[model samples]
Target: NSSDAFLLYRVNEAIRKSGAVVEFVREHIILENMVSIFGNTEKQAELINILFLPIVWGFFHIIKAFFSTPLSALSDKIGRKVTIIFGWTIYTSVYVSFALIVFLPSHIQIPVTFVLFTIYALFYAFTEGTEKALVADMVPEEKRGTAFGMYNLATGVSTLPASIIFGFLYTYFEQQFPGYGGTFAFGFGGSIALLSMILFSFLVKAKNR
Candidate 1:
């Protein structure tokens, strides 16, 4: 029951982190492109940072807080498996959108980037707490401590290599493909996340059977 949930949590964390590294790289690439397009003057860069830092961050956090409880309730009603699958679907779709955004004209990229990042924050609300509850549901009262510890350990370990591998892949792709390298790298990472979701679905199904 919850065992598969725990396993999926670990796998999802690993892949999510890996994909996130690529996303980070993409952000830097985007930032650089923006600087080049808009000029490298300090005042211009400061204005750009101002637009993102407080406004985008605050907007996303507000939206996430507003939706978190509703999503948690929905998960309680529909089941953790479905909720997690939904979150992963959104997560994968966000990355896919990021990949596609690379093809759009530079003028439209900034606004689209902010929208996608906000959606990613919203999707996180769906899975963040619900998965922990799923772990608790699957374990015995006395054993939950151990179960949670192990879950944390698995996810923690997964994070270490995820960034490293993603960084290497990002560098390789950027070198090989020039403008589209970051897109390819991010798409690759997103595909890995999608594969993890598929595996998680299968694990959940097998557990249910």
Candidate 2:
């Protein structure tokens, strides 16, 4: 999910810097092009964080607030494994949809991006606390602390390599494929997420059986 996050960030930044509503530049839409247009990386990043991220996150937090408690309660009723798997499925699907934004007409990009981000917030509501509960359910009471520490450590550690790999993939693909590199990187991340969901589902099934 962190990989997907980083790739999506790049995609959003690219879209923002490209002037989503106007056709100011005619070259391939990548980070460098954004920098070139904006005159520097810092300004471009600032504009996105200040102008774009706020609106997206504002809607996201609203959706998350509305859905979080219900999703957690649903997980308790339906079981953690099922809830987590379903969340991962939504996450993967959202990433795939994010990747496909390049295929859509330019006029709808902002609305579509906001909708996907909102869905992603809902997905987080389902998995965030539920996964920690699943960890607690799996491990013994005595070793719960250590189990959680290791679980968090693994997720945190994986983010560094995930970021590096996806960053490189984005740059490489953008050079090779022009306007489609970010999409490729996002699609790749979504594929990885989908595979993870399937493997986790199998493990959960076997454990329950």
Q: lDDT (0-100) at residue 83 of candidate 2?
A: 88
Cα-based lDDT for every prediction: 0.63, 0.75
For candidate 2, which ten residues in a row score worst on lDDT?
19-28
Per-residue lDDT of 1-209 in model 1, one digit per residue for the tens? Answer: 11112222222233232343223334687765655555455555444544444555567678889888888778777888888889988878876676566566554545665677578776778988777777877788899999999988887788767766666665687699765555665677679889988998887541221
Runs with alpha carbons beyond 4 Å of true place in candidate 1: 1-43, 46-54, 205-209
Please write out the lDDT profile of model 2 over residues 93-154, one tens digit for every residue.
98788777766766677778778888888788999888888888888899999999999999
User: What's the CA RMSD for each of the models?
Assistant: 9.6, 6.5
Candidate of highest TM-score: 2
Instruction: Please give me the total number of clashing residue pairs in predicted model 1.
Output: 0
